[model samples]
Target: MRALFCYFSATGNTKKCIDLYQNYLSLSGVESDIHNIDDGKLEFNPEDYDMVFFAYPIHGFNAPENVLKFAKTLKKCKEKKRLIILKTSGEHLRINNISSYSLIRILKRRNYYLTNEYHYIMPYDIIFRHTDLMAYNMYEALKGLVPLDVKDILDNKIVKLKYMPFGHLLQIFMLIEHPGAKINGLFMHTNKNCISCGLCEKACPTKNIEIDEKGKVHFKHSCLMCTRCAFYCPKDAIVFGLFNSWKVNGKYSFQMPKEEEVDKHKRYCKNSYNRYFKIAEERIKNQK
Candidate 1:
């Protein structure tokens, strides 16, 4: 079987999950190709593959803007193609499940049916950074869970979420961030700490960031608010406008660090995060 992975990853967590999925699927005898949705380019036809995986990060309780736009551009498939959704979020809130509502609606109209939907918890790109230990654990959980999920797909297991009432309304409401992000992008400014290395400009998926000849970074109104500019900033220079306080910088090493070497977060989202990890652990063990 052949598969296509189309994804939008801001801080790389969702992309990491895609890599894991692709590797595991290959082990199951499936060949796959990848499309980065942020590029606004579709290199392969969905009909050419047996299945298409839509992978992305949950942004503002919804799929990022580029993903939705890309879905609309897909040609209407004559044969119903299977589309699998894999979303990554910082925490495991039920509300996060609604992120796929808009993307799924657009795809279904183009004749792509939802086959399976899976959610994984990754480190935060915004709000607050997860400790290295937590990030490591999340990565490990992702590694363990993806193989099992890939096996289920190979076996034709119809794993999908039940329909939710008023899901459309909720998804529409969450889309406020769509326009809000563009406006918010205008407010992003660099502080003295910025080295004018032009890193943010090159990293911006939307090309919303630019560095002038005089070494000043400017943010455009086209921002998708994926936080790529801020998260990957070498000096943590980009401030997130109104949400500057919530900005999380630096890449996740996903490496095992000694527990004593890392500082622990003070039980923030304690119950929810704990429950998520616990459930993931159980799933991994039971599958074993």
Candidate 2:
């Protein structure tokens, strides 16, 4: 069978799992194509593929806005199309059972069948989120889940799914998390260590980072809070905190491409690239 594998990966973990899943598909002799959703060149008719495998990182216990938008983009797809969701997270327990529910709701809107779902406990790179040793242990534990997941998908099995706690609570939490996730970017500030290399600007999936005429980088409110900027900043200059405090910053290392090489995996976006920028702009304006 043919498949379309689309994913949004802040760090390489989700993409890494996607690659292995695709490799498994290849070994099974199934045909498939892959796309990075934020490439900003969204195009696909899920009706054309026998199955669609969507993978992404769980941000703040919910699917990123882009993923929701992608679901809307597939509105015209035929009904009963097979869909499988794969998420990668650091704390799978807190990935929020509602996260999967949110995705199921998205699929239901389009009348797509949720055939199977899975999540991987990949290494968490957020510095304050987890330590290097914890990440190593998590990676070691989660990596083994992939091979079996691949076999289940290939065999068209009704795979069991895992959910996080507090269904109603997480559903309500989403409302709060929505604004909190976006506003988190407002807390992102660059330090004196920033060389203005524009690394953070290019690495953003939402095009939330912009360089003004002063050649200084600004973080807009379109952020996904995936920590790509904090993880990729060359000098560790991107600091995110609460109440202007940096002590709680997460420190995790993620391999990043050079600024010029970012386009190979992601698209460069600015405030205008996001639909809520006007509101985000107003918020930023009022904050100052």
Candidate 3:
């Protein structure tokens, strides 16, 4: 049976899990094709594959907007088998299901079967700002146990011993409302350090950041709080106030070298050149 692994990743944590899964599948002799959602539009015949894997990071307690759109599009297909949703979240796995549950309800209404749902934990996003190294280590250990054929592991009594208590606590925490009132609206701004590198816009999964007519970076309320922009920023210009304090504390900071910095004035023009040139090359090769 063939499988299709479709995924969206921002900080590469989800990609890391996908890589591990792909490696396990290969060792188990499973035939699969992996695709990055950014590479191109997915146009596949579901009849050609026996299983489909939707892997994505949970953002703002929801699946990234792009992944949600992909799921909606696939719902129109007549494939009968349930799709596997492998999600990675900054929170514990139990709370992670909050978003997956919403997506599953949508797909089910469209006649798609909901197969097994799995959640893995990763470092918190810049918005949520959590840093528990112990939790991260436990998450890694659990991931190592998920074999290509996970039924056996699922049936084992020891599974509960490993993940139950923490999972239950996460679920309980998900039910509690934040004491602080939610912000109705906000905007992100870049400081002078912004090299105008455009990496923030490119890394944003929701496409919420854009260059305005005056050539200044602007953000919308659609941000998932994933902090891909702040974390990946070459110049460390993007700021989100208290939401990004963990980064300020150096937990999520990713230092880039001076040589890697892009010119502030040439950001958009250079990005456009690279994007179109790559597209042209792909078109030419496909025509052959």
Instruction: Please give the CA lDDT of all the candidate structures.
Output: 0.89, 0.68, 0.58
TM-score of each prediction: 0.96, 0.78, 0.66
How do the residues 1-288 of candidate 2 rate in per-residue lDDT, one tens digit apiece?
A: 898988999877788788888887888888889888888665766787888888888766678778877766666465588889888875545334466676677777787778988766665555234444444444544444556667778778988465545675666567565577677778778888888888889889889999888878888878777677777777778777452342223443433322432122122222222322343344445544
TM-score, structure 1 vs. true = 0.96
What is residue 85's positional error in candidate 1, in angstroms? 0.2
Ranked by lDDT, the better of candidates 1 and 3 is 1
Q: By lDDT, rank the candidates, best first.
A: 1, 2, 3
**Highest lDDT scorer:** 1
Candidate 1 lDDT score at position 98:
84
| Ranking 2 against 3 by TM-score, winner | 2
Residues 66-154, candidate 3, lDDT per residue (tens digit)?
67667676645564754677777654533345666556656666665655666665555543333343234434443554552254322
- Inter-residue clash pairs, candidate 2: 97-164, 125-252, 127-250, 127-251, 127-252, 128-250, 128-251, 207-269
Two-way TM-score contest, 1 vs 2, winner: 1
Pick out the ten consecutive residues of candidate 2 with the lowest summed lDDT: 261-270
